[model samples]
Target: MSTAVTAGASGAPRRVPATVHRRRWAILGVLIFALLVVVLDNSILNVAMKTIASPAPIGLGASQSDLEWAINSYTLVFAGLLFTSGLLGDRLGRKKVLLAGMVVFGGGSLLSAVAGSPGQLITFRAVMGLGGALVMPATLAIIMNVFERDEQPKAIGVWAGAVGLAIAIGPITGGLLLQHFWWGSVFLVNLPIVLVALVGMVLLIPDSRDPNPGRLDPVGVLLSVIGLVLLIYGIIKGGQLADFTDPAAWGTVAGGLAVLAAFVLYERRAEHPALDVTWFRNPRFSASVAVIGLVFFALMGVTFFGAFYLQSVRGYSALKAGALLLPLAVAQMAFAPRARLVVDRYGVRATCAGGMALVALAFLGYLTLDTTTPIWVLEVIGFVMGTGMAHVMPPVTVTIMSALPREKAGSGSAINNTFRQVGGSLGVAVLGAMLSAAYRNGMSDHLSAVPPALRGPAGESIEATLGVARQLGPRGAALVDPAKESFVHAMHIVAGTSAGVILLGAVVALVLFPGRLPVPDAVGAQPEAEPEAAPAETA
Candidate 1:
């Protein structure tokens, strides 16, 4: 039987083909499995950093900068290529692209597992990211393709829940693997999962693509990739050097932004634009993007530091720290379903803003953290932040997708995720930089009385400081408490700053997002022709 979409009268709902309706849930499972592996890879490394950087068999002796790159390199490459990857999937076959991505990602994981140096690991991570760019957008785009409008919210809810589940499980999985096996086991573990997903995807999912896929935009691709990489490079460099005024830092940032501006202008004029520049004109879409970006900015920034705080300062083992983070996952899972209901009853503006406010309050709560603070208090704070994040992400993602025509879902999903990846990258870059600078200054003052020979390495990082203290025997005991204290002080500053930024995002959501989303036109409705002189809205 040939499946078909039945067109509706004006304002009426379109009928989904019977073929699609029957297989939708099965397709969703494959998509979620793929998404889980990609999202899980993003955080699993956090728990294993200690092992990777430790001095021994797998010793890389990675500096703070090297560690940050090990994490951000994947994100930076993922963000830069998302739009282009989406375009290719739309023009080529989505399933083919997805299968190919899985292969590449699996290969990257294999290489990463055997990596001997920080640089090799970082490079392989970027390779995984290239594959991720294909997988991420294709998952959502496939969901949009296979499901009807009425089913979309629920399906998207499931998709969003899978992401939260990945975040929750990633650390625990890494911690367990690190406890019994080597740090390389984290990357190695992806192989079996990828194999299962690949088999399922090939057997269950059908290929789909844009019927009228347009010309490839080479210049636009070049500008976006270059601009984003340079911008992120500058941010990471600034943090490492701890100098905002360095020409290499600020200058590259300025140049990157300028190139991006040119790309936007060119996109408006191009007949077959890689990204529809006018999507920002819709306030609901733009505000939702901003809110998601800011939420991740805070989430990633805190997660990066929090892992270190638990292990390095509080002296929790990797397994314990990962176990402690389970409360966050539990809270998020508890709240995710309710968040959808809240959006239905209260509207996105209220739900999103309220969620942001909760996250800000959580951050404020962390301001009191110290070496002596109870473990239960940290759990409470994680729960509060996780619940708030649960509220924010789902509705915001749905809103962004709802604003676009179903045919444009791949590109739209890519754009939405691109901002998210960019925000997370920046979060780690900016917050990591701040923590590094503050720790250096605080430790410099605290360790001034120590022997000059010990000052330099001790000031390099919290791990280095503790390592130095361990070497000095009884004399090193004096440096241990002060180093931990300095680290806590830096953490306090990061939490406070993150709170303010999240609050600002909440205000933006409240002010910019409409009280309710405008009623969307029929699914697959042709977008109106772009106006020649439409003013670009700032994102």
Candidate 2:
């Protein structure tokens, strides 16, 4: 019956209607469904790429770079716009923005289904990314607002689990769709899910926004978007070229970093800042972010190449490849709920470190995989990796969300998701570059005896190499066997590198995260030097 006063982003108090608390759990279900759709869109395209690029009735004639762009463009735009979108939601009602995002995302998917060219598909995917940016942060911010501090970790666990669940299901769903219909089926599948989320969100979710919402920062938005686009562009180009020495590659990367640095400087001094950079000053926040980024870095990189290894090198159908990944999904879903309990008992630092250790162990196992490695071996390793990911994500996400004041939840959620998207993009770029370079070099040495014209395509990609092999008939064995060997060697190199990065993250988590979650009263408590500001007057 009474309104509860809560601190706003400006440290001013604002009244939250008591009725808002009653609908929290039902609201969480809607947020999770919304989250599932956005997260699934990120990976569902992976298994559908080959079909989309195939020649004839559904031919897109997409080159390797085009295929990579189809994926990277979405992530790049999503990462770039997240901070701004979150701030917009805080200013303009999260529920309003979330519903709008669903419309945009659904529209993009529909456009993508009928796209006649690779360029059109890439453009539509970017549109979807814009919608995803709007959707992702609001889900987390709404969860923070609805759930009380004590209930947050469990709620966040379910939210985090939805992400893992989407990752697990996206490929299989795409595989099944591709089997029954065309490649466009993958994008089209989002419609029914989005429609359901829209209706549920409209009915169950309450609208919330900053009571003291400040002036918009257009400069900050511009700089962040341009910088992220350039940065991601350079990374993707570097991977494609396998040569960072190119002036264009290094120049873009340097310029992007400089612009981002400028954006940070501008934010700190801006009267109405879009992001609170001071959050990173907290060791727990910084460490949790680092752990999240590193985990995704390794996981995304492995998934990017691993899918190809299964489908291309091992000669598995897309459907079968998707089925094989089931072990990973199962392990992740099974472990995520229990991870919070582990954090409650052992502490955030221990749980995260243990998770990273398991991930490193899984990567170590992957190093042994080759053309002859059995499917069972991969399934077992995938299970191990998934379990590790499950452990790392839920606790780390809870830690980050827990560290922030309720008013800053939108920006905080955006920052966390931004790091994750950035990490995944970089992971695919860096690890893919490593794989590309190694594969090219290995193929070159073996193919030196072949005609120069035929050798070029063979060296460019595994798919091209296989095509060359097929055309050569009986003579193809010479090129085929060596190409497979080269791919295996390249995969091993990337796997080993990923193991090292995750091990470093484990060390960082151990060093930085506190032994336990902060006490409820201490969580996001304001500084003693700054007394509580007066509540913002209701209109």
Best by TM-score: 2
- Each prediction's TM-score versus the true structure: 0.92, 0.92
Score each candidate by Cα lDDT: 0.81, 0.82
Write the residue-wise lDDT of candidate 1 on 83-194 in tens digits: 7888777778678888988999999999999998899999999999999988999898788777665557678877877787898789889988887888899999999999
lDDT of 2 by residue, 14-113 (tens): 3333355556788899998899999887668887887878874865778777887888778778888887888888778788889989999999999998
RMSD of 1: 5.9
